[model samples]
Target: MTTVTEAVPPAPAKHRDQVATSLPPARGQSFLKLVTLELRKSVDTRSGRVLIAAILLLAVAAVGWQLTHLPRGTINFDGFLAAATSGPVMILPVIGVMAMTSEWTQRTALTTFTLSPRRIRVQLAKFVSAIVLGAVVTTGVVVLALAGTALGGATSGRATSYAGMGGEIAAGYLTVALNVVMAAAFGAVIAQTAVAILVFYIAPTAWRLAGPELFKDNANWLDVFGALGRIAERDLHGMLPETLTAIGVWIVLPTLVGLWASSRREVK
Candidate 1:
């Protein structure tokens, strides 16, 4: 009995650090945190910084150009807002394109996807960040335009109109924001910065130019720019169906395709 009583040793317990490392993190990545990271990444690069600086400078230049060229009587808050918004709206889509495409172009997709395996969440963060950037740029443009309007009015003794301008400006902001988001979707689908940017600008312009000749009476329904134009003119109520159709074709379809592609595409 004594010879058979050999004691067994206890297994060594894993240290707390080893246990922690063995498991996934206790907290999952947060939406707000992802959005914040995306936003920061948007402008952290040299090109990103340049694009941002160019946007601000262009907005200022546009306001100044309008002041010098337009008659003082013609310079109003609404007009200023429109002109200032044009600068950023023209270029913000490129920023959107770069935002999504850079993940692959810069070879960071592997790291990004690895950290967050749910690619849709990453896509959503990029989309939300683009919207946030659009909103901020729009607000800045509006502020600058307001300052310009005040200066012009004070110096020239011209009357400024505040009535019925809010809706128009808001519509412009929304249209611009939608356009940016659409470009981001295009980038997500295309996965190439230059190609996405080119298609985003040229394809729309070409369609607008050729649609009337090619599609005849139905072109407007399929025209992305046309839908956006209706929005810019504050004619959403009148053209709601056509606008929705255009969005379905241009935005919704591409977004769905992009999400599908992103989900299955191998992360290199």
Candidate 2:
């Protein structure tokens, strides 16, 4: 007699397929999270605290000194903005460098890269955060400086127009924002905060003091710092093309290189 064999059940192949098809990290859990996380990390550290305090102090001092020492005339609040921005400009690159280099210096690069998987995203997040931070700080300072100048001018019976200062102050902030981006790019390219700071600090001073005789002919196009100084004058004066090009070179190129490098390098 032939015995009927029980039918064997088939495995759930569709369930396996569905598991395979499931997407990676949700769309909401991307770049912005990484940036916010990074910013938080930065704010929690002593170094970060010191750096921020220094920047604020410098801003306050620069404005205070200018208001007190500026030759009595129109009480140029715009001019004070220009002076105040100089401090932030000098520090912007250093801040960028610190943001990038700190990952390595603080031994967080490995964790950051591993979690993100896309190293470039991490680098870009740092960059965007730095730019935003710089712009916020610079703009806030400009507003404060204007208010302080207005109060002093009003009490002293001096001629200071907040309306007139608006354009110049805006230009000063724009300059600071641009420089912040450029500095972050440089830090990314260099992968070292110290070097980026040195380069950022020295390049402008050196160029102004020892530039070639033809410097005047090409200064409008080649000098990043000079562009800021010129722009602070608030006329544009046909310098936008040159300023844009210089920004691309000094900031964009380096940032791209750094992103590529960060993507390729082995996290430590």
lDDT of each: 0.84, 0.72
Q: Give a tens-digit lDDT track for model 1, residues 1-268.
A: 4577668865456666676789976799999999999999998999988987888888899899877766745456777787887778889888789888899899999999999988999998998898888788777878888888888777677787666678877897788788988999899999999999988889878988999998897888888988888888877757788899999989888888888887888788
**Poorly placed runs, candidate 2 (over 4 Å):** 1-28, 70-74, 203-221, 239-241
Give me the candidate number with maximum lDDT.
1
lDDT computed for candidate 1: 0.84
Candidate 2 residue lDDT tens string, 1-268: 9999999887689977888789574564467898888788767889877877788788888877776775667776666676676676676556667777788766788887767777777888888777667776677677767766776687678888555765665676667767777777767766667776787678766765665455866665666666666666776578789877666766677778888877776676
Q: In order, how many clashes per candidate?
A: 0, 0
Per-model TM against the reference: 0.89, 0.79
Deviation of model 2 at 215, angstroms: 7.5
Question: Residue 210 lDDT in model 2?
Answer: 64
Off by over 4 Å in 1: 1-25, 70-75
